[model samples]
Target: MAWKVELTETARKQLTRLDKTQAQRITKYLRRVMMLEDPRDAGKALTGNLRTYWRYRVGDYRVICEIRDAELVIVAVEIGHRSEVYG
Candidate 1:
């Protein structure tokens, strides 16, 4: 089943800091990939303290999210470049 996607307030701020094209690309990836498929197939599960979250790659950017299976929802927690996203 398709999942519902929501961007957290911090994630929204991060997206706004990206260039227009980059931001659009991330949004497209979220809608077309994350929302349409099982989130587990779209991104890898993060480890460490972030083990509950997943990371989706788009070019140089990464979209960090948490999947709630019971709700069929994908909540995007952050969006940023590869170098900065993990930190």
Candidate 2:
């Protein structure tokens, strides 16, 4: 089933602050893969206090999402570089 993808306000702001090329790359990846594919099949489940979220990697960045099964929406909670994303 195709899932709809959305970015939280924080995530949107974070994305805009990234380099133009990185932002474009992330947008393309979300549209092509996160939107079209089964989100659970492609993303890795997070752990610890963040266990409810799922994570998808695009190059050096990470996309942290919360999957809403009933609504069929994948909400991006945060987006950042590998070194700082989880913190």
Candidate 3:
């Protein structure tokens, strides 16, 4: 029962803006997310819309990701900075 995490295109571009250390940090966070049995267990909040956000803190940066059910799987829609995430 492992959670599946998928990165959106925007998130992929955002990675280029991060420093080497931060990039590695994001990779580590992905590993943790992969180990999750339930995506919601690691989810911090849900606005009751079509979105749920799972947060992972890496130093000063926050990795904000979205989860949605795809058949029997949970899909990670996007990942980005906290500053521009909620807005």
Clashes of each: 0, 0, 0
The lDDT for every candidate, in the order shown, is 0.90, 0.91, 0.63
Give the range where candidate 2 is weakest over 10 consecutive residues by summed lDDT. 32-41
Q: Rank the candidates by lDDT, best first.
A: 2, 1, 3
Give per-residue CA lDDT, model 2, range 36-81, as digits (tens).
Answer: 5577777899999999999999999999999998988999999999
Residues 1-87 of candidate 1: C-alpha lDDT, one tens digit per residue: 778899999999999999999999999988886556577887899999999999999999999999999999899999999999898
Tell me each candidate's RMSD, in Å, in order. 1.1, 1.2, 2.8
lDDT value, candidate 2, whole model: 0.91
lDDT of 1: 0.90
Please, what's the RMSD in Å of model 3? 2.8
Candidate number with greatest lDDT: 2
